[model samples]
Target: MEEEVNNELPLPDIEVNSDVPRGPFALLNRYGNKLKRLSSKGGENSSKSQLLSAMTIMNMAEKVLSQSIHEKRGDVSNLVEAFGSDYADYLKRVVWLLDASEKLTKRQYDEAEELLVLALSGSLEGHPIETVLTFYGKYLQEKIEVERGRIDLERKVEHVDIEQAVMDLKVGVVECEQKLPYSQISNFTGVQTILDSVAAAERIHFIDFGPKFGSYWILVMDALARQGVKQLKISAVFSATDSVEETGNLLTSFAESMNLPFVFKILHLDTWEFKKDHLQLEAGETVAVFMKFCLMPLSDQPNGIGALLRGIKDLNPLILIVIDVEADINALDFAHRFKEALLLTCALFDSLEACLGRGNHYRKIVEKVHFQEVICNGILSEDGGFKRCFKIDLWRKYFAEFGLVEMELSQPSMHQARLMVKGSPSWSCCTLKMNGKSMIIGWNGIPIQFVSAWKFHYPVSPAIDLFILH
Candidate 1:
């Protein structure tokens, strides 16, 4: 039996002849053309094409089955008999995924959950699409669980195993810092700013708020060692829930190895709870503040960030370094937040896919711990969970309102950022650009993270100026 399908001609080459009858074959060709057009744009449009294409195939199959039934064909088998059973099964799964994607885009959680469940029932291993689908499925499931009050029990369990969770988070953050360019850029720029701001100081006191694995301080310690600093004190501030002893020990070991006089102190307080008294500033020591990937969560509390900034200003640090993700998920409606979070996370996942193999352990860890937390908190949390990221512009305005002035990052840091991006073949799509005084690292033209330096606009009194001048 000869099939009416024309596989030889490409979709664009298939002409819609006016003389041809308006049969299923002609309609299929027209729909195929539309699919091609939609798929060319990529991203969400590609998902749309999948939806349209799957629906069109199902519609054609229905028409064929209807015809077969009307003609009294004995034991009419598959409607897509020409493509065989495997193709039919594949089409069904694709349809479910497409339907789920549409539902997620429309914020229809219940329908999306059902469709994703169906799609995931079959084997989808070793495919990028499988990863994407799995992420969405987990997100939807979490949302459903949250609505049913089932996640609260899980949160309690997490708190009970807080040590293990913190360990996992530390591992994930280390993996991210090692694999991705954002942390490297921020750390390098921040270290350079610190060095420049305190060139003449013999003793430096560095205060780190929400320290991540003590990686930034490692860089600072290395730089200060090279600069022949006589003494160094690092105060690592952590939230009450955070396990700080491990990080304190690591920094202490590293500092001893460098033969630098280092004092490590752990302060257990939220960022908003920090005060000048907590720092215990001493005479003849230059103080600098570092906040990396931590400030955004303060938005969850009313005026939390403002309070922190005011406290930091009172400390009169020579320089304040901030490294934060570039996003506008805070203060947005659920629908808008979902859209923005989806776009941001898709780019992040795409970048990860480009850089790491599908089965890489670090990639799995990063996706599970880092990206999943951001996606869920950004979109699913009712009270703007920990990942309430805002853009650099908004952060700039906030700093200015708190009496902090933006400072330009040094040229070497800029050159290092560009060289880092250019040196890696996998990071070819990553880009670096300066937004005013801040340095932005983007993937595929979408800003992912930013690093900026700031200082109090008003200098301290002469009576308190015991440290060496900049």
Candidate 2:
């Protein structure tokens, strides 16, 4: 039997928006509602419709999780594997659609759609369904060829090798996370403030400092939806470059799928040039803005950071949420002599200069030699990597002058940061504990929180959030 051709909807142009909620409860409800509706009426067979379903399920399931409830802190330690179990089934469906699109006649197309609707609704599994779909697609393609009086078989491309394609798909998904993972962010100080401010804002203007596809905003969409404001719109400014596209797609799809009462516009402003978006903030428009895990890059290259801040000053967001990352020093200069600490802790580096390029981004760390050493030979210690403790005091001064009253948003101390450390990348595993109520950490024991140099991708702590929020 000949196979059929599958037609899926074209991907949409993606971008960012500012007024998204960072909470998960609301989203859970929304997903539950959608699942109910689909289970009741059966799933859709249209390529785009099925793809959307797959994405929604996958998006909701992105986190490494063991519990579904958020308040149960006891179950926090049982970490679900990075890629949970449901992923395999979802991947299979996606593969079936992609490989079997070339074998369907129109009649078979209709039948295949019905079969797909059924297949997606239940636990039935395997290549049989895929082969059937492939057969249908081939049948349609053959019929079309017959009408045109064409005879060509050798030129046909076979289905993608399932195992290899699945492997590649896993890599693609991981690569997507490599671009930015909420888990990598352990220090979450300003996230809650940003969420609260944005959720409360009557009108909001937002800026995504690095703006990788706006996943952080998706996390916050639920709050934005509940604001109940008759006139609510969020304007987001982002880097206008290819670096921002992939994440932008997820952000856009998420926003569209939720059908929130807000709109988004993604910009391509280069940090080097310090281009700012010409925003139109009206009176009574309450603006709450945040930059996700982008402080390091801006700090290392201050000229661009200065330009971005100058642009930000123009809009004057009511509350500015800055989520900073600790590693990726190429983005900035480390405080408290981190190189000395890295050299002391890591055997690979005989001296601070030698270790700067390893584990740490070699290029940027060595660009300037003003790092302070915190943990000596810590990287080589039986644990994953050395713990280089530092602070973000510089940002405090920069924003303080603007009349922003800062509050420590993190729970303060990460005592026995072992659980948290396990979640970090193998190359960058170290812990920081708070002594007293101070937000500062020591390099070999020096208080440096005032330096404003911590960094991360999302402000949400992965250990705590993975179960319910991811």
Candidate 3:
């Protein structure tokens, strides 16, 4: 991302995300400032770190969870005192953000109520905190007071039929096909590269984290079919043991109809875990892993995403395709979480409004089910261990920690995404954003979802090298 330093827009109080444009004069060593704020500093603090975190809510929001470290060390006073009086308000704002976040985490929206108001009016950072917060507050009120979605947020732990939830998600996804185009763009952005890399292999394999009716599987088959791959081996892994037989039948029919040597094996996970034993891989089969909106839900558990990723790393797949709805829905604060969810749902709702008009009752029904499963359940509701989704930067950090290197999502992929947006009806106003490494699907320029590809980075075995030398 380019640092378009516009020193002219003066906002003395606001701080911004590194990629977010800001009003304040560009500080000295602005590059360092960006790096410190974005990195996981792990209780380490410097003059630069203190200044940036103290001055900006985006950085400070991250550090809020670490207040215990300071408290345990009897340095809570240092938080307010260190920045000096001139910037104390900024630090105090950070405190308020932290407090509000805590209240939200405990499911106390009322206590964090003022924080949302502050988020609505305040613009102390580069991120669009105010813009998103404003929408979130309104959205939250509507969800609570009005019965728009089937998944009610007020009811804690309401029993929802698993089959009904699955069907609703399917309905929502079907409606989203022509309207949103996010999944298509994601599939278009990365699947071809994986297919191209594995096309000539005698046998091919797949381990989808959450197949959910085999959408990514369909994309893979299409790409390979175009590559004239006549035979292959395929596997899908899902934590939820739903519709395994039906999914197998669907893929088997596709492979047989295409005259390919393919087998679809389903692992109906007895436990809600990503166990290597469940993969059922055969020797010499090139494996490509698919994780699409599946890992985020598991993030609610401690070490959930990391452990599963480690399992994936152990497998040493030929390619890994990671896709998710791009939003900051995982802020540790209620107001911020709400903002992220609002931004994400706004794009979906807008796309539907533009394409699926109100007169179409079936489309509305589908949209409602989708809104509940994706928006209400996936993002807003505190039940079902729902947690917020992180942005691209955090995901990159997590991938790096797990020894995964980004596979350059091809230029043709970017062009493919761009063409999809351009080729849409002239009335549709969504845009595609490709920041070289990742692609974001946006509505009215606010990014709602992101997609990227990665491969495991294996360190060279020194023992093997020494043996070869001997």
Candidate 4:
């Protein structure tokens, strides 16, 4: 018989292994800040080194419990103190044992192990090693417990510092929820509320200003199709910051798949920049500009509202859908300004509100991905703050100034829930009574005017008509 030739390729060497492997729970540069509080001249040592040392010692002790260090467990007799008598002495002992483990002779390893166990068991009172070693001890116990139920087969349970582990888990769950396949759920449910309100309008065009990935727009288009929206031409202008080709392609594919009559195109400029462009005025295209979570980045940019109104007029769309985060305690704070600014527009004006809530839900959600730095640090005016709530008022005002009025929606989008996603549509609106009388209430708890849609009519007459009418 011929010998079989082995064909499987060897796996690459994995350097990160047990004894406190670097992972989500591993020490980070944040620990350096804690260490800085302990030393007067902490500048001498880089924070990275201190963090590395702390993580390594904790990791080693977590894996091999019986190992020892040359230095006595939790003994700080010869070391220089830091912080106070209690905190300084304890930290020294922890650092000394960690240092001893670095050389890692048999006795030193054993001693280090003893110190960690003693610290976790609370036998070594008054030592701050408890705080540092706690993660390792918990991980060690979890590993032991996990292995007991699965003796026949090897099983490994991932563990990190409790806080980091919790954060990671929350992020994973949220991402999974947002990433559900479209086929799994009918798309109509998502945009049904918006469609119903705008159904009476003469011409309707969906305009997504910042169409990141275009998933939301696709869903909205699908929902419109379900509502018997056959001859709709959508002229979307996406900010260039996100992947343009990806968004354009996805929108095209979604439009094609649904066999919808829509001309979808992504813009190559920022939403703020789009406002500056001299767009050619078109007749009867009910331009509903959907800018969900995008406006926050340009909150401080001068003439942001004016730019939006100008863009709407240039398009001469019958309706302009203005959606964004209602980030304020007072709904009037947002609505009053938004309505005022939008009224300046010569085109039609109609507004609606949805998903209105208290604290800035949109900003809080974006902060998770380090995008907060952009809003807080980048968009902030030289004065370090601006009337964030002003955008809401401007939109509301613009609606009133234009001929179109608010068309109340029976079912509006949930404000806080949408804030969970890091995309546009993450906004809130104050609920108000939509009688012909436009009353701005300082208002108590009961939701009154919760209008988020701005639906208006642009006359099919030439641009001269607009100028003459104004």
Q: Which number leads on lDDT?
A: 1
Q: Pick out the ten consecutive residues of candidate 3 with the lowest summed lDDT.
A: 461-470
Between prediction 2 and prediction 3, the one with superior lDDT is 3
Model 3 C-alpha lDDT per residue in residues 1-470, reported as the tens digit of each score: 11121112122243432232221111111233322332222112211222222113333433543664436323433665654555544545445544554555565666566654543455544322332233344444444333334454556433334445565466554544534456556665566556655756766777766545454465566555655654566666664555656667877788777766777776666223667777777788788887777656665664566667777877788888888867666544454564455446545654454444434345445444444444454335554356556677777766775677887655444544454444445213556656547766665555657787888886422111111111
Specify the poorest-scoring 10-residue window by lDDT in model 4: 344-353
Q: lDDT of all predictions, in order shown?
A: 0.61, 0.35, 0.53, 0.35
lDDT of 2 by residue, 100-162 (tens): 221122234444444344325444232222322233334334434433446453344233332
> Of the pair 1 and 3, which is ahead by lDDT?
1
Question: Order the candidates by lDDT, highest first — what do you get?
Answer: 1, 3, 4, 2
Query: What is the C-alpha lDDT profile of model 1 across 1-470, one tens digit per residue?
Result: 11122112111222433232232112122223332332232222112111222223333434454455444323234444554664454444434544454466566767867776776777644444455556655665666566656777346322122234447566654644455656655676677667767878888999888636465576677767766888998888886434567767877899889898889888888778888898777888898988887766666664677677778888778999899889877644564565456556655766665555454556666666556666666546664343477888877766665677999776545554554554455565666777888887776566788889998986432221101110
List the candidates' TM-scores in order.
0.70, 0.40, 0.62, 0.40
Q: What is candidate 4's CA lDDT for residue 59?
A: 31
lDDT of 4 by residue, 169-228 (tens): 444323322322111111222233345445655446666664333354555666556556
- Tell me the RMSD of model 2 versus the true structure: 23.4
lDDT of 2 at 378: 16
Give the best candidate by TM-score.
Answer: 1
lDDT of 2 at 204: 57
